[model samples]
Target: MTTSAATTTETPSVSQTKTGIRFWRRLCRNRLVTVGLVIIALQLFTAVFAPWLTTYDPTAQDLAVKELPPGSEGHWLGTDEYGRDMWSRLVYGSRISLLVGISSVVLGLVGGVVLGLLAGYYRWLDGPIMRLVDLMFAFPGILLAMLVIAMLGTRLINVVIAISIWSVPTCARIVRGSVLSLKDREYVQALRSMGAGDGRILFKHLLPNCAAPIIVFATMRMATAILSTSALSFLGLGAQPPTPEWGAMIAAGRDYMWTAPHLTIIPGVAIMLVVFAFNVVGDGLRDALDPHMDVTYES
Candidate 1:
């Protein structure tokens, strides 16, 4: 009885210690990641509660107050060319940016993972898929997006599709590199020796190991997708008029840049902040996930 009781107590204590160690390690290596989380959370909150956060409807136009300065009586970040409230528009627009970024990344992740796994696992299949990936990598991501939008026409769904297409090659390359390393591991060889099927070995053994790098890449891609979406919207190939997109807002505010510099500055800063936050967080994730990294700093 005493032995069992002692075992139970020690087991929980050991687990608790491990949990504490993990928490401390994550905190130490990921302070920027924590800050990024806070920023992203704040953005999500603003997007979710946009109506409650602002008084005026983002779409409501009051021509009498058109182009009002910041902190105007009825408007906060001022009015746009259409006399729409800036603050409200910005708050609501967060949803469009986040939605586009996340959806595009997710679609890219799924497609890339499948194709990458197939290419890595089957030597005969590698040539065609890799050549396609190379073709995608040849073009600049923004230029590719622009081309895709030009072909697909300027709709929100087209923006997502365009971004997804540009993202897949990057994700495929990352996954392929990871799989190249992992496929030759002793455990994988053992699984093959045990007569494991290709499907099971690839999905069960290889795919899970790709998580760390995939996550790191996904975070970075999220930021990139957001920036690309904004650029597209700015060029009138993304979100349409009165949609409160950040890039569209910047485009609309360009004429006023000389008179009310705040117009472009606000949205531009917001874009920078969001992208910076994701990059910092991605770096933290990469560091934390790197098995070769040392947790203890040598004195």
Candidate 2:
């Protein structure tokens, strides 16, 4: 009777401890993670409210006021090469950057996950798929993107597709590793023994288990995608001039580096902040989602 009572008492204590740990893990309880979340939230807000946040039309250019420094009447962050408000363009331009970042990541994730899952599950398909993935891996991501863009003729959608192709190999490699590790686990073997279909075993049982790594990879990939977009735009293969893109803004401002430094600095800072935010968040997720890493919360 006493042992039974003790067991009951310990059960709730264990449950409570697990609950507390889960709470902390969900948010990653790390200082950098919190700061990253705040920065990301602010960027999202800026993107969502770009129209209301900016007082001037980003594309409406006044040649007379070109290259005005910050704090000139209506223009807060000053004017660019064509006298368009820098602040307004940066805010609106975020929408494009983020849109490309997220969409390309999603495309890459879908392609990678599908291919990796199949390659890992079926030994027959592994050689061909892995050899192709190996070929892609041999090329630097940016160079591969540049080559694809050059071949595709510099269209926006093609740029996204180009980046997505480069992104897929990395994600596929990660997922393949995960699936390879998981295939030998008892749960997977049990499912196989129980006559579970390959599709059910792969998707329902295996894929969900890979979520943590996938989420981390997706977050990191956002930064990569944004960088690729900016590089493409800077090279004139991305968003055209007068289109309020951060890369183009910096590209245009490069000639005035000796004089109108803010033109390049502002957009450069925006790219840096966005990339930094994604990286911090990705690192936090890695720590949080590591099941073996115990998170001790101090009240």
Candidate 3:
């Protein structure tokens, strides 16, 4: 009996490991996913080692050397209008972009999950929470962000808050739909019949089953969060000047577009790459998580 119980106890862990390995294999089968992973890894590495990656202080300015072209003497990738090294500012900007993206997604996902869980599990709360979610969803993400920023005023933290709030409605809907399907499943029903409390049933049993969609949603949402942050900054409602944020850098470089186009081009390309990476990875994740896609994927 003890041996049988031991085997049963180990089965779930072993099955989970096998599932994860299968997911990884499926994800890596796509060459674009490989490229996306490499880009994301490099971006993370750059953000962590930003100080050492570039010698110049990103915020420091020198009028004398301002607007120097790329590969001109010690400064490579040129200097912005403020004469700060573009390389350094770009490197440091990765830190801001990643921080905002991750922070906002986490906050949004948490709020969304809680609301979704309550709405899904308790029939009484469903109408009110879903109506609130509907109201939020009525506006575009950028518009919602603009309204939030207008009310709260602009700061990096406010950018996070705005983006997070924007994210919540989408996330909530995703999770709510997932939960509605999962709550009536046999495992959840079994847990409920076994006298497990609602919290345990909701969090322990139902949540795990809902994870695949959430994971895919969050991965895609990161791209939107980063892009939105940059957009707001570009409009002068996000990061202030001298912050070395990619959007702010582009905003400053707009005046020099005719002469030193690299100022805008460089950061624009960075934003494009980062957004592309996240999107491709999100697609890969969606494919991997969806059982329907499994038969289509090359072995």
- List TM-score per model, in order: 0.91, 0.90, 0.94
What lDDT is reached at residue 102 by model 2?
90
**Which is the winner by TM-score between candidate 2 and candidate 3?**
3
Query: How close to the true structure is residue 215 of candidate 2, measured as C-alpha lDDT?
Result: 96
- Which 10-residue span in candidate 1 carries the lowest summed lDDT? 290-299
What C-alpha lDDT do the candidate models reach, one value each?
A: 0.88, 0.88, 0.92
The candidate that achieves the highest lDDT relative to the unseen native structure: 3
Off by over 4 Å in 2: 1-28, 295-299
Residue pairs in candidate 2 whose N, alpha carbon or C atoms collide under 3 angstroms: none
Runs with alpha carbons beyond 4 Å of true place in candidate 1: 1-24, 27-31, 295-299
**Which sequence of candidate numbers ranks them by TM-score, best first?**
3, 1, 2
Alpha-carbon deviation at 150 in model 3, angstroms: 1.2
TM-score result, candidate 3: 0.94
